[model samples]
Target chain A: MARIVVEVMPKPEILDPQGKAVAGALPRLGFTEFAAVRQGKRFELEVEGEANEEVLDQARKAASEVLSNPVIEDVVSVHWARES
Target chain B: MARIVVEVMPKPEILDPQGKAVAGALPRLGFTEFAAVRQGKRFELEVEGEANEEVLDQARKAASEVLSNPVIEDVVSVHWARES
Candidate 1:
């Protein structure tokens, strides 16, 4: 089976409270090098066959239409897991 | 500034209800090519400087210790955003 990986991130203009919370907590935990944190979603879709162009196209459609909310999140990347 | 990307996924043996819900929804939405779906987290950590080896190392540490719960989640990947 092939796996397609999809990544979604909050839009730059959007305020991500969960990300903010993590950023705040990081310093307290002594990870002071990070200036900011943005948390988002990742998805792995397993298919019966290879992750060919057709499968990738379907994965992209699913990513934008079902996985991510276009109002606040952007579908950052979508590709075969092996490519990553 | 440079950004480090960290990915976390539920352990294989763990039950991922959220992922299961998404998988179930896909066929109903006509995206039936997928056999399974796994949901995970993507984190972008912004740093003041370039994402060099040291920064990536620190990001890896933070990913494991602070970003994910070792009991149920696994830090799947940690790398420079540019590389992705």
Candidate 2:
């Protein structure tokens, strides 16, 4: 089986409320050197298919269409590798 | 700086539409031996603080409070390591 990984994150210009909440609490937690925080999601997929080139592209398309929010986020990438 | 990594995933019973879409496409991509697909998110934070015990806990709390969806997901874990 092949495993494909994808990461989804909010755009830099977009405001991530989740990130902001974490950033706001950093000072109380004792880390006082951060100016910002951003939150994102990662997906690992066990692709069931022959090790073909098209498999990776299919995975990417699936991610773009259904896995991530395009308007508020960008820079989604897919990494594919054989199971070890 | 301390780097903290966290992974968030939906509970096993929760249906991941993204995963289902990917699973549905496996045959078209050339593989026909898979039964399911699941997705998750990973976060890497450049925690700016002294390498202290509380720093790690802080990062975890930050993730739990803001980075993950507790209602739909569980098994959120945080990993802390110093920059080499």
Candidate 3:
């Protein structure tokens, strides 16, 4: 099967409260030396087809239109690979 | 600086309601042919250190202990790279 992965991250200018919470807790959890922390979304699309160009384009369109809000989020990468 | 990315996904046995919702909407949004979809978390840790083995281990530990819940979530990949 082909696995398509899409990464959706908040815009650099946007305030991520959840990420902030995690960043605030890291030091307490004994993890430090972080310049910053940003929490985002990881989407795994298990496709029943091959990882062809057309399929990848369709996945990208889906990610842009449905998976993320362009105003607040940025689609970092779309990876298409055969996983088993 | 090194960018350490930790991908936290719901266990395979777990039901991902949010991913299901998105999958259900994709077809309506004119994107289809997806066999399955699982939504997860993408954590971007902007570290002030180099991408050495020790630092990578520390990042992995932080991801397992603080960033994700081991009972319901699994760390799919831990990526450490330098990005300009």
Candidate 4:
């Protein structure tokens, strides 16, 4: 089976409280170098055959329409997981 | 500023209900090509200066110790965002 990866991130203009929380905790945990953090979603979709152009297209369509909320998140990428 | 991307995924033996829910919904939404789905997390950590070796090392440490629960998740990757 081929695995397709879809990544979704909060829009730049949107507030990400989860990311902010993580950023705040990092220093306390002794990881002091990072300036900021943004949390996003990653999805792996398994298909029966190759992750061909057609499957990638379908994955992209699914990413935008079903996996992410257009009002707050952006579908940043959709590609074969192995390539990543 | 430079960004480091960290990816976390559920262990292969771990049950991912969220991913299963999304997989179930996909067929109902008319995108029937996918056979299964697994959900994970992506983190973007911003740092000042270059994303050099030292910064990447810190990101890798943070990815495992703070960003993911070692009991259930794995730090799949830690790398410069631009390269991804």
Q: What's the lDDT for all of these models?
A: 0.93, 0.68, 0.87, 0.92
lDDT tens string, model 1, B45-71?
A: 999666578878899999999999999
- Residue-level lDDT tens digits of model 1 in A1-84: 789999999999999999999999999998888999999999999986666799899999999999999999999999889844
Candidate 2 segments exceeding 4 Å error: A81-84, B1-6, B10-35, B44-84
Q: Clashing residue pairs, candidate 2?
A: A42-B40, A42-B41, A49-B31
Clashing pairs in 3: none
Candidate 3 regions exceeding 4 Å error are: A81-84, B82-84
TM-score of chain B of each: 0.93, 0.80, 0.91, 0.93
Residue A17 lDDT in model 3? 93
TM-score (all chains, Cα) for each model: 0.95, 0.60, 0.94, 0.95
Q: How close is candidate 2 to the true structure, as a TM-score?
A: 0.60
Tens-digit per-residue lDDT, B1-84, candidate 2 = 556767788887898997687677756765454456777776667756565667667667666766677888764567763355
Model 1's interface RMSD? 0.8
Please, what are the lDDT tens digits per residue for candidate 2 over residues A13-77? 88888778777776777556455666777776775657466767766776676667788876456
Question: What lDDT is reached at residue A83 by model 1?
Answer: 49
Residue A44 miss distance in model 2 (angstroms): 2.0
- Order the candidate numbers by TM-score, best to worst: 4, 1, 3, 2
Deviation of model 4 at A54, angstroms: 0.8
**lDDT assessment of candidate 4:** 0.92
